[model samples]
Target chain A: MLERLSDKWVTLVLTGLASGPRRYSDLSRRIAGVSQKMLTQTLRGLERDGLVRRTVTPSVPVRVDYELTPLGESLMPLVAAIKGWAEANIQTVEAARKTYDAA
Target chain B: MLERLSDKWVTLVLTGLASGPRRYSDLSRRIAGVSQKMLTQTLRGLERDGLVRRTVTPSVPVRVDYELTPLGESLMPLVAAIKGWAEANIQTVEAARKTYDAA
Candidate 1:
Protein backbone atom coordinates (compact mmCIF):
# COMPACT_ATOMS: atom_id res chain seq x y z
CA MET A 1 0.00 0.00 0.00
CA LEU A 2 2.84 2.35 0.81
CA GLU A 3 4.32 1.37 -2.51
CA ARG A 4 1.12 2.40 -4.27
CA LEU A 5 0.92 5.67 -2.40
CA SER A 6 4.56 6.40 -3.03
CA ASP A 7 4.11 6.32 -6.79
CA LYS A 8 4.89 9.61 -8.58
CA TRP A 9 2.07 9.20 -11.06
CA VAL A 10 -0.34 8.42 -8.27
CA THR A 11 0.62 11.68 -6.65
CA LEU A 12 0.09 13.63 -9.85
CA VAL A 13 -3.23 11.98 -10.69
CA LEU A 14 -4.52 12.58 -7.20
CA THR A 15 -3.51 16.21 -7.38
CA GLY A 16 -5.26 16.57 -10.70
CA LEU A 17 -8.43 15.14 -9.21
CA ALA A 18 -8.25 17.12 -6.02
CA SER A 19 -10.34 20.04 -7.25
CA GLY A 20 -13.14 17.85 -8.63
CA PRO A 21 -13.99 15.20 -11.17
CA ARG A 22 -12.18 15.39 -14.52
CA ARG A 23 -12.40 13.69 -17.84
CA TYR A 24 -9.51 11.55 -19.05
CA SER A 25 -8.31 14.25 -21.42
CA ASP A 26 -8.31 16.87 -18.70
CA LEU A 27 -6.03 14.76 -16.59
CA SER A 28 -3.78 13.95 -19.51
CA ARG A 29 -3.43 17.62 -20.30
CA ARG A 30 -3.10 18.86 -16.72
CA ILE A 31 -0.41 16.40 -15.80
CA ALA A 32 1.96 17.32 -18.58
CA GLY A 33 4.64 14.78 -19.60
CA VAL A 34 2.50 11.83 -18.44
CA SER A 35 2.10 9.30 -21.17
CA GLN A 36 -1.41 8.02 -21.98
CA LYS A 37 -0.49 4.50 -20.87
CA MET A 38 1.00 5.70 -17.61
CA LEU A 39 -2.01 7.91 -16.88
CA THR A 40 -4.44 5.07 -17.51
CA GLN A 41 -2.45 2.72 -15.34
CA THR A 42 -2.17 5.24 -12.55
CA LEU A 43 -5.91 5.84 -12.59
CA ARG A 44 -6.57 2.12 -12.56
CA GLY A 45 -4.24 1.65 -9.63
CA LEU A 46 -5.88 4.45 -7.71
CA GLU A 47 -9.34 3.07 -8.48
CA ARG A 48 -8.29 -0.38 -7.35
CA ASP A 49 -6.85 1.07 -4.19
CA GLY A 50 -10.23 2.73 -3.42
CA LEU A 51 -8.61 6.13 -3.64
CA VAL A 52 -10.36 7.12 -6.83
CA ARG A 53 -13.75 6.57 -8.42
CA ARG A 54 -14.42 6.26 -12.12
CA THR A 55 -17.77 7.53 -13.28
CA VAL A 56 -19.15 7.00 -16.74
CA THR A 57 -22.10 8.91 -18.14
CA PRO A 58 -24.27 7.82 -20.98
CA SER A 59 -23.85 10.63 -23.48
CA VAL A 60 -23.03 11.21 -27.14
CA PRO A 61 -19.32 10.78 -26.51
CA VAL A 62 -19.76 8.54 -23.50
CA ARG A 63 -18.13 10.77 -20.91
CA VAL A 64 -15.80 9.31 -18.31
CA ASP A 65 -14.79 11.22 -15.21
CA TYR A 66 -12.48 10.42 -12.35
CA GLU A 67 -12.82 11.79 -8.87
CA LEU A 68 -11.62 10.98 -5.41
CA THR A 69 -13.50 8.58 -3.19
CA PRO A 70 -13.98 9.47 0.44
CA LEU A 71 -10.97 7.31 1.08
CA GLY A 72 -9.08 9.23 -1.57
CA GLU A 73 -10.35 12.54 -0.29
CA SER A 74 -9.04 11.64 3.12
CA LEU A 75 -5.59 11.31 1.66
CA MET A 76 -5.55 14.66 -0.12
CA PRO A 77 -4.27 16.66 2.83
CA LEU A 78 -1.27 14.41 3.17
CA VAL A 79 -0.67 14.58 -0.54
CA ALA A 80 -1.08 18.31 -0.50
CA ALA A 81 1.29 18.52 2.42
CA ILE A 82 3.86 16.51 0.54
CA LYS A 83 3.45 18.73 -2.51
CA GLY A 84 3.67 21.83 -0.39
CA TRP A 85 6.86 20.59 1.14
CA ALA A 86 8.30 19.88 -2.26
CA GLU A 87 7.45 23.28 -3.64
CA ALA A 88 8.77 24.99 -0.53
CA ASN A 89 11.97 23.04 -0.25
CA ILE A 90 12.92 22.36 -3.85
CA GLN A 91 15.50 25.12 -3.91
CA THR A 92 17.09 23.84 -0.74
CA VAL A 93 17.20 20.32 -2.11
CA GLU A 94 18.73 21.53 -5.37
CA ALA A 95 21.39 23.44 -3.53
CA ALA A 96 22.17 20.39 -1.45
CA ARG A 97 22.48 18.30 -4.58
CA LYS A 98 24.89 20.78 -6.18
CA THR A 99 27.00 20.84 -3.02
CA TYR A 100 27.04 17.07 -2.75
CA ASP A 101 27.97 16.73 -6.38
CA ALA A 102 30.86 19.13 -6.01
CA ALA A 103 32.16 17.41 -2.89
CA MET B 1 11.62 16.50 -5.54
CA LEU B 2 8.11 15.03 -5.45
CA GLU B 3 9.42 12.14 -7.48
CA ARG B 4 12.16 11.51 -4.95
CA LEU B 5 9.81 11.82 -1.99
CA SER B 6 7.38 9.40 -3.64
CA ASP B 7 9.97 6.68 -3.93
CA LYS B 8 9.18 3.51 -1.95
CA TRP B 9 12.75 3.10 -0.76
CA VAL B 10 12.81 6.71 0.40
CA THR B 11 9.66 6.14 2.41
CA LEU B 12 11.07 3.04 4.04
CA VAL B 13 14.45 4.60 4.76
CA LEU B 14 12.89 7.70 6.29
CA THR B 15 10.66 5.57 8.46
CA GLY B 16 13.61 3.46 9.52
CA LEU B 17 15.50 6.56 10.59
CA ALA B 18 12.53 8.21 12.30
CA SER B 19 13.66 7.15 15.73
CA GLY B 20 17.23 8.46 15.60
CA PRO B 21 20.60 8.06 13.93
CA ARG B 22 21.47 4.54 12.81
CA ARG B 23 24.36 2.69 11.25
CA TYR B 24 24.10 1.48 7.65
CA SER B 25 23.77 -2.09 8.95
CA ASP B 26 21.00 -1.09 11.32
CA LEU B 27 18.97 0.45 8.48
CA SER B 28 19.67 -2.60 6.35
CA ARG B 29 18.36 -4.90 9.07
CA ARG B 30 15.36 -2.77 9.93
CA ILE B 31 14.07 -2.31 6.39
CA ALA B 32 13.74 -6.01 5.71
CA GLY B 33 13.26 -6.10 1.93
CA VAL B 34 15.88 -3.53 0.86
CA SER B 35 19.03 -4.74 -0.92
CA GLN B 36 22.47 -3.36 -0.06
CA LYS B 37 22.78 -1.54 -3.37
CA MET B 38 19.32 0.00 -3.06
CA LEU B 39 19.87 1.00 0.56
CA THR B 40 23.18 2.56 -0.31
CA GLN B 41 21.62 4.41 -3.23
CA THR B 42 18.66 5.55 -1.16
CA LEU B 43 20.90 6.82 1.61
CA ARG B 44 23.09 8.62 -0.89
CA GLY B 45 20.04 10.19 -2.50
CA LEU B 46 18.70 11.26 0.87
CA GLU B 47 22.06 12.72 1.79
CA ARG B 48 22.24 14.54 -1.53
CA ASP B 49 18.75 15.92 -1.03
CA GLY B 50 19.86 17.33 2.33
CA LEU B 51 17.40 15.19 4.18
CA VAL B 52 19.96 12.98 5.91
CA ARG B 53 23.32 13.50 7.55
CA ARG B 54 26.08 10.88 7.59
CA THR B 55 28.76 11.01 10.25
CA VAL B 56 31.75 8.79 10.74
CA THR B 57 33.44 8.13 14.10
CA PRO B 58 36.95 6.82 13.67
CA SER B 59 36.92 4.23 16.42
CA VAL B 60 37.23 0.42 16.61
CA PRO B 61 36.57 -0.47 12.99
CA VAL B 62 35.10 3.01 12.49
CA ARG B 63 31.48 3.80 13.23
CA VAL B 64 29.10 5.54 10.80
CA ASP B 65 25.67 6.87 11.58
CA TYR B 66 22.92 8.38 9.45
CA GLU B 67 20.32 10.70 10.88
CA LEU B 68 17.65 13.04 9.59
CA THR B 69 18.77 16.59 9.05
CA PRO B 70 16.55 19.51 10.05
CA LEU B 71 15.06 19.55 6.57
CA GLY B 72 14.36 15.86 6.79
CA GLU B 73 12.95 16.18 10.29
CA SER B 74 10.56 18.82 8.99
CA LEU B 75 9.18 16.32 6.53
CA MET B 76 8.71 13.51 9.04
CA PRO B 77 5.19 14.36 10.20
CA LEU B 78 3.91 14.22 6.64
CA VAL B 79 5.66 10.91 6.07
CA ALA B 80 4.29 9.57 9.33
CA ALA B 81 0.81 10.69 8.37
CA ILE B 82 1.14 8.88 5.06
CA LYS B 83 2.29 5.70 6.81
CA GLY B 84 -0.48 6.02 9.35
CA TRP B 85 -3.06 6.34 6.60
CA ALA B 86 -1.75 3.25 4.90
CA GLU B 87 -1.94 1.24 8.12
CA ALA B 88 -5.44 2.41 8.95
CA ASN B 89 -6.88 1.87 5.49
CA ILE B 90 -5.12 -1.24 4.25
CA GLN B 91 -8.11 -3.47 4.87
CA THR B 92 -10.48 -1.20 3.02
CA VAL B 93 -8.05 -0.90 0.13
CA GLU B 94 -7.61 -4.67 0.01
CA ALA B 95 -11.37 -5.15 -0.07
CA ALA B 96 -11.67 -2.60 -2.84
CA ARG B 97 -9.03 -4.41 -4.86
CA LYS B 98 -10.83 -7.70 -4.38
CA THR B 99 -14.07 -6.18 -5.56
CA TYR B 100 -12.35 -4.53 -8.48
CA ASP B 101 -10.74 -7.75 -9.55
CA ALA B 102 -13.96 -9.70 -9.31
CA ALA B 103 -15.73 -7.37 -11.66
Candidate 2:
Protein backbone atom coordinates (compact mmCIF):
# COMPACT_ATOMS: atom_id res chain seq x y z
CA MET A 1 0.00 0.00 0.00
CA LEU A 2 1.14 3.61 -0.61
CA GLU A 3 0.72 4.35 3.10
CA ARG A 4 3.00 1.52 4.20
CA LEU A 5 5.65 2.22 1.61
CA SER A 6 5.59 5.82 2.80
CA ASP A 7 6.77 4.67 6.19
CA LYS A 8 10.40 5.65 6.85
CA TRP A 9 11.35 2.34 8.42
CA VAL A 10 9.93 0.39 5.52
CA THR A 11 11.99 2.46 3.07
CA LEU A 12 15.14 2.00 5.11
CA VAL A 13 14.55 -1.71 5.63
CA LEU A 14 13.94 -2.31 1.96
CA THR A 15 17.01 -0.31 0.95
CA GLY A 16 19.08 -2.03 3.62
CA LEU A 17 18.04 -5.48 2.47
CA ALA A 18 18.82 -4.49 -1.09
CA SER A 19 22.46 -5.26 -0.50
CA GLY A 20 22.00 -8.94 0.47
CA PRO A 21 20.65 -11.25 3.14
CA ARG A 22 21.21 -10.05 6.68
CA ARG A 23 20.68 -11.58 10.08
CA TYR A 24 18.51 -9.83 12.67
CA SER A 25 21.52 -8.52 14.55
CA ASP A 26 23.18 -7.32 11.40
CA LEU A 27 20.10 -5.41 10.35
CA SER A 28 19.70 -3.81 13.75
CA ARG A 29 23.31 -2.70 13.69
CA ARG A 30 23.28 -1.43 10.16
CA ILE A 31 20.09 0.60 10.54
CA ALA A 32 21.34 2.85 13.36
CA GLY A 33 18.21 4.28 14.95
CA VAL A 34 15.69 1.43 14.68
CA SER A 35 14.70 -0.40 17.82
CA GLN A 36 14.41 -4.19 17.93
CA LYS A 37 10.63 -4.13 18.17
CA MET A 38 10.35 -1.73 15.25
CA LEU A 39 12.71 -3.81 13.11
CA THR A 40 10.78 -7.00 13.89
CA GLN A 41 7.46 -5.36 13.09
CA THR A 42 8.78 -3.82 9.86
CA LEU A 43 10.20 -7.12 8.65
CA ARG A 44 6.92 -8.87 9.43
CA GLY A 45 4.99 -6.21 7.54
CA LEU A 46 7.31 -6.41 4.54
CA GLU A 47 7.15 -10.21 4.58
CA ARG A 48 3.37 -10.11 4.72
CA ASP A 49 3.38 -7.65 1.85
CA GLY A 50 5.59 -10.13 -0.06
CA LEU A 51 8.38 -7.60 -0.42
CA VAL A 52 10.76 -9.35 1.95
CA ARG A 53 11.72 -13.00 2.36
CA ARG A 54 12.66 -14.52 5.66
CA THR A 55 14.79 -17.63 5.82
CA VAL A 56 15.61 -19.69 8.91
CA THR A 57 18.42 -22.22 8.95
CA PRO A 58 18.03 -25.58 10.59
CA SER A 59 21.35 -25.34 12.40
CA VAL A 60 21.86 -26.00 16.13
CA PRO A 61 21.29 -22.42 17.20
CA VAL A 62 19.00 -21.71 14.28
CA ARG A 63 19.86 -18.58 12.28
CA VAL A 64 17.42 -16.26 10.51
CA ASP A 65 18.13 -13.99 7.56
CA TYR A 66 16.10 -11.44 5.64
CA GLU A 67 16.36 -10.50 1.99
CA LEU A 68 14.27 -8.69 -0.62
CA THR A 69 11.95 -10.60 -2.91
CA PRO A 70 12.00 -9.91 -6.62
CA LEU A 71 8.98 -7.67 -6.16
CA GLY A 72 10.80 -5.75 -3.49
CA GLU A 73 13.92 -5.53 -5.57
CA SER A 74 11.85 -3.97 -8.31
CA LEU A 75 10.97 -1.17 -5.92
CA MET A 76 14.62 -0.23 -5.40
CA PRO A 77 15.03 2.18 -8.28
CA LEU A 78 12.15 4.36 -7.16
CA VAL A 79 13.30 4.27 -3.58
CA ALA A 80 16.86 5.07 -4.52
CA ALA A 81 15.73 7.98 -6.64
CA ILE A 82 13.69 9.38 -3.79
CA LYS A 83 16.59 9.02 -1.40
CA GLY A 84 18.91 10.75 -3.81
CA TRP A 85 16.47 13.62 -4.28
CA ALA A 86 16.00 14.06 -0.53
CA GLU A 87 19.71 14.22 0.13
CA ALA A 88 20.27 16.68 -2.68
CA ASN A 89 17.40 18.97 -1.72
CA ILE A 90 17.60 18.88 2.06
CA GLN A 91 19.36 22.21 2.25
CA THR A 92 16.83 23.88 0.01
CA VAL A 93 14.05 22.50 2.18
CA GLU A 94 15.77 23.73 5.31
CA ALA A 95 16.21 27.22 3.92
CA ALA A 96 12.59 27.33 2.90
CA ARG A 97 11.53 26.28 6.35
CA LYS A 98 13.56 29.01 7.98
CA THR A 99 12.20 31.67 5.64
CA TYR A 100 8.64 30.48 6.17
CA ASP A 101 9.09 30.44 9.91
CA ALA A 102 10.56 33.92 9.94
CA ALA A 103 7.68 35.42 7.98
CA MET B 1 13.58 14.62 4.48
CA LEU B 2 13.07 11.05 3.23
CA GLU B 3 11.01 10.35 6.33
CA ARG B 4 8.58 13.20 5.61
CA LEU B 5 8.19 12.27 1.93
CA SER B 6 7.23 8.75 2.96
CA ASP B 7 4.14 10.09 4.70
CA LYS B 8 1.07 9.12 2.64
CA TRP B 9 -0.72 12.39 3.20
CA VAL B 10 2.38 14.26 2.12
CA THR B 11 2.56 12.24 -1.08
CA LEU B 12 -1.12 12.79 -1.84
CA VAL B 13 -0.92 16.47 -1.05
CA LEU B 14 2.14 16.90 -3.24
CA THR B 15 0.58 14.92 -6.08
CA GLY B 16 -2.68 16.79 -5.71
CA LEU B 17 -0.88 20.10 -6.06
CA ALA B 18 1.03 18.80 -9.04
CA SER B 19 -1.70 19.79 -11.50
CA GLY B 20 -2.04 23.44 -10.45
CA PRO B 21 -2.78 25.68 -7.49
CA ARG B 22 -5.67 24.51 -5.34
CA ARG B 23 -7.71 26.16 -2.61
CA TYR B 24 -7.88 24.61 0.86
CA SER B 25 -11.44 23.46 0.20
CA ASP B 26 -10.53 22.12 -3.23
CA LEU B 27 -7.59 20.16 -1.85
CA SER B 28 -9.76 18.69 0.90
CA ARG B 29 -12.31 17.66 -1.70
CA ARG B 30 -9.78 16.31 -4.21
CA ILE B 31 -7.93 14.15 -1.72
CA ALA B 32 -10.89 11.95 -0.77
CA GLY B 33 -9.96 10.52 2.62
CA VAL B 34 -8.09 13.36 4.27
CA SER B 35 -9.67 15.19 7.21
CA GLN B 36 -9.46 18.99 7.50
CA LYS B 37 -7.06 18.79 10.43
CA MET B 38 -4.83 16.22 8.76
CA LEU B 39 -4.86 18.19 5.53
CA THR B 40 -3.85 21.37 7.35
CA GLN B 41 -1.09 19.56 9.20
CA THR B 42 0.21 17.85 6.10
CA LEU B 43 0.24 21.05 4.12
CA ARG B 44 2.01 22.91 6.90
CA GLY B 45 4.59 20.19 7.10
CA LEU B 46 5.07 20.24 3.35
CA GLU B 47 5.39 24.02 3.37
CA ARG B 48 7.91 23.81 6.17
CA ASP B 49 9.81 21.17 4.24
CA GLY B 50 9.79 23.55 1.25
CA LEU B 51 7.78 21.19 -0.94
CA VAL B 52 4.46 23.06 -0.98
CA ARG B 53 3.91 26.77 -1.34
CA ARG B 54 1.05 28.49 0.49
CA THR B 55 -0.24 31.79 -0.85
CA VAL B 56 -2.84 33.99 0.71
CA THR B 57 -4.96 36.40 -1.35
CA PRO B 58 -6.71 39.41 0.19
CA SER B 59 -9.89 38.90 -1.77
CA VAL B 60 -13.57 38.67 -0.66
CA PRO B 61 -13.17 35.56 1.48
CA VAL B 62 -9.36 35.84 1.57
CA ARG B 63 -8.55 32.71 -0.38
CA VAL B 64 -5.49 30.59 0.38
CA ASP B 65 -3.96 28.51 -2.41
CA TYR B 66 -1.42 25.71 -2.32
CA GLU B 67 0.99 24.68 -5.04
CA LEU B 68 4.18 22.65 -5.34
CA THR B 69 7.51 24.47 -5.39
CA PRO B 70 10.22 23.72 -7.90
CA LEU B 71 11.84 21.33 -5.42
CA GLY B 72 8.49 19.70 -4.81
CA GLU B 73 7.70 19.47 -8.51
CA SER B 74 11.07 17.84 -8.94
CA LEU B 75 9.90 15.01 -6.71
CA MET B 76 6.87 14.27 -8.87
CA PRO B 77 8.50 11.63 -11.01
CA LEU B 78 9.63 9.56 -8.05
CA VAL B 79 6.24 9.82 -6.42
CA ALA B 80 4.51 8.84 -9.63
CA ALA B 81 6.76 5.82 -9.95
CA ILE B 82 5.95 4.68 -6.43
CA LYS B 83 2.23 5.12 -6.96
CA GLY B 84 2.41 3.17 -10.18
CA TRP B 85 4.29 0.38 -8.50
CA ALA B 86 1.76 0.22 -5.68
CA GLU B 87 -1.22 0.05 -8.01
CA ALA B 88 0.40 -2.63 -10.13
CA ASN B 89 1.58 -4.72 -7.19
CA ILE B 90 -1.39 -4.40 -4.83
CA GLN B 91 -2.83 -7.70 -5.97
CA THR B 92 0.51 -9.39 -5.67
CA VAL B 93 0.98 -7.97 -2.20
CA GLU B 94 -2.52 -8.93 -1.15
CA ALA B 95 -2.10 -12.49 -2.40
CA ALA B 96 1.21 -12.73 -0.58
CA ARG B 97 -0.39 -11.44 2.60
CA LYS B 98 -3.10 -14.08 2.47
CA THR B 99 -0.55 -16.79 1.87
CA TYR B 100 1.65 -15.61 4.71
CA ASP B 101 -1.28 -15.32 7.10
CA ALA B 102 -2.64 -18.74 6.27
CA ALA B 103 0.62 -20.56 6.82
Candidate 3:
Protein backbone atom coordinates (compact mmCIF):
# COMPACT_ATOMS: atom_id res chain seq x y z
CA MET A 1 0.00 0.00 0.00
CA LEU A 2 2.76 2.39 0.96
CA GLU A 3 4.68 1.22 -2.07
CA ARG A 4 1.71 2.03 -4.28
CA LEU A 5 1.21 5.50 -2.84
CA SER A 6 4.91 6.21 -2.99
CA ASP A 7 5.39 5.67 -6.67
CA LYS A 8 5.26 8.77 -8.89
CA TRP A 9 3.45 7.32 -11.88
CA VAL A 10 0.92 5.50 -9.73
CA THR A 11 -0.29 8.68 -8.04
CA LEU A 12 -0.54 10.50 -11.35
CA VAL A 13 -2.43 7.61 -12.92
CA LEU A 14 -4.72 7.22 -9.92
CA THR A 15 -5.45 10.91 -9.78
CA GLY A 16 -6.07 11.05 -13.51
CA LEU A 17 -8.46 8.14 -13.29
CA ALA A 18 -10.14 9.69 -10.30
CA SER A 19 -11.41 12.55 -12.46
CA GLY A 20 -13.58 9.89 -14.16
CA PRO A 21 -13.21 6.72 -16.15
CA ARG A 22 -11.08 7.32 -19.24
CA ARG A 23 -9.90 5.28 -22.19
CA TYR A 24 -6.30 4.24 -22.55
CA SER A 25 -5.73 6.94 -25.14
CA ASP A 26 -7.63 9.54 -23.14
CA LEU A 27 -5.49 8.90 -20.10
CA SER A 28 -2.37 9.03 -22.24
CA ARG A 29 -3.49 12.39 -23.53
CA ARG A 30 -4.64 13.74 -20.19
CA ILE A 31 -1.54 12.86 -18.26
CA ALA A 32 0.70 14.62 -20.75
CA GLY A 33 3.90 12.86 -21.84
CA VAL A 34 3.51 9.61 -19.93
CA SER A 35 4.59 6.84 -22.28
CA GLN A 36 2.06 4.19 -23.23
CA LYS A 37 4.18 1.56 -21.53
CA MET A 38 4.21 3.43 -18.23
CA LEU A 39 0.48 4.09 -18.35
CA THR A 40 -0.23 0.47 -19.10
CA GLN A 41 1.93 -0.67 -16.24
CA THR A 42 0.40 1.81 -13.85
CA LEU A 43 -3.18 0.99 -14.75
CA ARG A 44 -2.40 -2.68 -14.41
CA GLY A 45 -1.10 -2.04 -10.92
CA LEU A 46 -4.18 -0.07 -9.91
CA GLU A 47 -6.45 -2.70 -11.39
CA ARG A 48 -4.61 -5.46 -9.62
CA ASP A 49 -4.80 -3.58 -6.34
CA GLY A 50 -8.58 -3.20 -6.79
CA LEU A 51 -8.37 0.56 -6.81
CA VAL A 52 -9.39 0.78 -10.45
CA ARG A 53 -12.27 -0.77 -12.34
CA ARG A 54 -11.66 -1.39 -16.02
CA THR A 55 -14.73 -1.89 -18.17
CA VAL A 56 -14.77 -2.68 -21.85
CA THR A 57 -17.74 -1.83 -24.02
CA PRO A 58 -18.59 -3.35 -27.36
CA SER A 59 -19.40 -0.83 -30.05
CA VAL A 60 -18.67 -0.30 -33.73
CA PRO A 61 -15.20 -0.18 -32.31
CA VAL A 62 -14.18 -1.49 -28.92
CA ARG A 63 -14.31 1.05 -26.10
CA VAL A 64 -12.68 0.62 -22.75
CA ASP A 65 -13.15 2.86 -19.72
CA TYR A 66 -11.24 3.11 -16.50
CA GLU A 67 -13.00 4.43 -13.42
CA LEU A 68 -12.13 4.66 -9.81
CA THR A 69 -13.56 1.88 -7.81
CA PRO A 70 -14.93 3.27 -4.55
CA LEU A 71 -11.39 2.67 -3.32
CA GLY A 72 -9.88 4.81 -6.02
CA GLU A 73 -12.33 7.67 -5.55
CA SER A 74 -11.58 7.50 -1.88
CA LEU A 75 -8.05 8.63 -2.74
CA MET A 76 -9.09 11.72 -4.65
CA PRO A 77 -9.11 14.04 -1.70
CA LEU A 78 -5.61 12.96 -0.73
CA VAL A 79 -4.36 13.52 -4.25
CA ALA A 80 -6.17 16.83 -4.35
CA ALA A 81 -4.71 17.77 -1.03
CA ILE A 82 -1.25 17.07 -2.37
CA LYS A 83 -2.00 19.00 -5.52
CA GLY A 84 -3.57 21.83 -3.58
CA TRP A 85 -0.57 21.95 -1.33
CA ALA A 86 1.71 22.15 -4.32
CA GLU A 87 -0.38 24.91 -5.82
CA ALA A 88 -0.22 26.81 -2.56
CA ASN A 89 3.36 26.16 -1.55
CA ILE A 90 5.36 25.84 -4.75
CA GLN A 91 6.25 29.48 -4.61
CA THR A 92 7.43 29.11 -1.07
CA VAL A 93 9.52 26.14 -2.08
CA GLU A 94 10.96 28.06 -4.98
CA ALA A 95 11.86 30.98 -2.78
CA ALA A 96 13.57 28.70 -0.33
CA ARG A 97 15.63 27.34 -3.14
CA LYS A 98 16.70 30.83 -4.07
CA THR A 99 17.72 31.57 -0.51
CA TYR A 100 19.55 28.31 -0.05
CA ASP A 101 21.41 28.83 -3.26
CA ALA A 102 22.42 32.36 -2.33
CA ALA A 103 23.84 31.27 1.01
CA MET B 1 7.76 19.26 -7.48
CA LEU B 2 5.20 16.73 -8.65
CA GLU B 3 7.85 14.07 -8.54
CA ARG B 4 8.72 15.09 -5.00
CA LEU B 5 5.18 14.93 -3.65
CA SER B 6 4.37 11.69 -5.37
CA ASP B 7 7.22 9.92 -3.68
CA LYS B 8 6.17 8.17 -0.43
CA TRP B 9 9.30 8.64 1.60
CA VAL B 10 9.47 12.28 0.61
CA THR B 11 5.93 12.93 1.79
CA LEU B 12 6.44 11.01 5.00
CA VAL B 13 9.74 12.73 5.63
CA LEU B 14 8.21 16.13 4.93
CA THR B 15 5.27 15.48 7.22
CA GLY B 16 7.55 14.06 9.87
CA LEU B 17 9.57 17.26 9.81
CA ALA B 18 6.38 19.26 9.56
CA SER B 19 5.73 18.62 13.20
CA GLY B 20 9.15 19.97 14.27
CA PRO B 21 12.85 19.44 13.70
CA ARG B 22 14.16 16.00 14.50
CA ARG B 23 17.39 14.12 14.50
CA TYR B 24 17.85 11.41 11.89
CA SER B 25 17.31 8.81 14.59
CA ASP B 26 14.29 10.65 15.85
CA LEU B 27 12.70 10.57 12.41
CA SER B 28 13.71 6.94 12.08
CA ARG B 29 11.87 6.27 15.32
CA ARG B 30 8.86 8.50 14.72
CA ILE B 31 8.13 7.17 11.29
CA ALA B 32 7.89 3.66 12.79
CA GLY B 33 10.23 1.66 10.55
CA VAL B 34 12.03 3.73 7.95
CA SER B 35 15.45 2.37 7.00
CA GLN B 36 18.37 4.58 7.92
CA LYS B 37 19.56 4.56 4.33
CA MET B 38 16.17 5.57 2.98
CA LEU B 39 15.72 8.24 5.64
CA THR B 40 19.13 9.68 4.94
CA GLN B 41 18.53 9.68 1.24
CA THR B 42 15.08 11.20 1.55
CA LEU B 43 16.28 13.92 3.91
CA ARG B 44 19.13 14.72 1.56
CA GLY B 45 16.73 15.01 -1.31
CA LEU B 46 14.42 17.30 0.63
CA GLU B 47 17.36 19.47 1.64
CA ARG B 48 18.60 19.55 -1.91
CA ASP B 49 15.17 20.68 -3.02
CA GLY B 50 15.39 23.35 -0.28
CA LEU B 51 12.24 22.12 1.41
CA VAL B 52 14.19 20.88 4.40
CA ARG B 53 16.72 22.56 6.65
CA ARG B 54 19.44 20.51 8.25
CA THR B 55 21.32 22.01 11.16
CA VAL B 56 24.29 20.56 12.93
CA THR B 57 24.90 21.61 16.51
CA PRO B 58 28.26 20.92 18.06
CA SER B 59 28.29 19.94 21.71
CA VAL B 60 30.31 17.53 23.83
CA PRO B 61 28.68 15.30 21.29
CA VAL B 62 27.49 16.66 17.97
CA ARG B 63 23.78 16.89 17.38
CA VAL B 64 22.05 17.28 14.03
CA ASP B 65 18.47 18.29 13.41
CA TYR B 66 16.14 18.45 10.47
CA GLU B 67 13.10 20.69 10.20
CA LEU B 68 10.91 21.82 7.41
CA THR B 69 11.97 24.90 5.59
CA PRO B 70 9.14 27.36 5.45
CA LEU B 71 8.44 25.57 2.20
CA GLY B 72 8.42 22.22 3.94
CA GLU B 73 6.27 23.46 6.80
CA SER B 74 3.92 25.00 4.26
CA LEU B 75 3.51 21.48 2.97
CA MET B 76 2.28 20.28 6.36
CA PRO B 77 -1.38 21.10 5.92
CA LEU B 78 -1.38 19.14 2.71
CA VAL B 79 0.39 16.19 4.26
CA ALA B 80 -1.99 16.41 7.17
CA ALA B 81 -4.78 16.56 4.68
CA ILE B 82 -3.54 13.36 3.03
CA LYS B 83 -3.21 11.63 6.39
CA GLY B 84 -6.60 13.00 7.31
CA TRP B 85 -8.07 11.73 4.06
CA ALA B 86 -6.50 8.33 4.57
CA GLU B 87 -7.79 8.06 8.11
CA ALA B 88 -11.25 9.05 7.01
CA ASN B 89 -11.46 6.87 3.93
CA ILE B 90 -9.17 3.85 4.32
CA GLN B 91 -12.22 1.94 5.54
CA THR B 92 -14.06 2.85 2.36
CA VAL B 93 -11.05 1.73 0.40
CA GLU B 94 -10.88 -1.46 2.38
CA ALA B 95 -14.55 -2.20 1.89
CA ALA B 96 -14.31 -1.57 -1.81
CA ARG B 97 -11.48 -4.06 -1.92
CA LYS B 98 -13.61 -6.69 -0.24
CA THR B 99 -16.43 -6.13 -2.71
CA TYR B 100 -14.09 -6.14 -5.65
CA ASP B 101 -12.49 -9.32 -4.42
CA ALA B 102 -15.84 -10.97 -4.00
CA ALA B 103 -16.86 -10.17 -7.55
TM per model?
0.82, 0.83, 0.68
TM-score of chain A of each: 0.82, 0.88, 0.75
Candidate 1 has an interface RMSD (Å) of: 2.0
Cα lDDT tens digits for candidate 2, B20-92 = 9999999999999999999999999888888888899999989999999898899899888887888898899
For candidate 1, the per-residue lDDT at B89 reads: 89
TM-score of chain B of each: 0.81, 0.88, 0.77
Listed for each candidate, the true contacts retained, as a fraction, are 0.79, 0.92, 0.35
Error of 3 at A81 (Å): 2.3
For candidate 2, write residues A1-103 as lDDT tens digits: 6566558898889988998999999999989899999999999999998999999999989999999999999988887887788789879988998998898
lDDT, model 2, position B63:
94
lDDT of each: 0.90, 0.88, 0.77
Error of 1 at A51 (Å): 1.7
Model 1 pairs whose backbones collide: none
**Cα lDDT tens digits for candidate 3, A1-103:** 5356656688788888766778988889888779989899888767766689889999868998998887677777766666677677777767766776677
Instruction: Provide the clashing-pair count of each candidate structure.
Output: 0, 0, 0
Model 3 misplaced stretches (Cα beyond 4 Å): A2-19, A29-31, A91-103, B1-16, B24-36, B84-103
Q: Is candidate 2 or candidate 3 better by TM-score?
A: 2
> Under CAPRI classification, how is model 1 graded?
medium
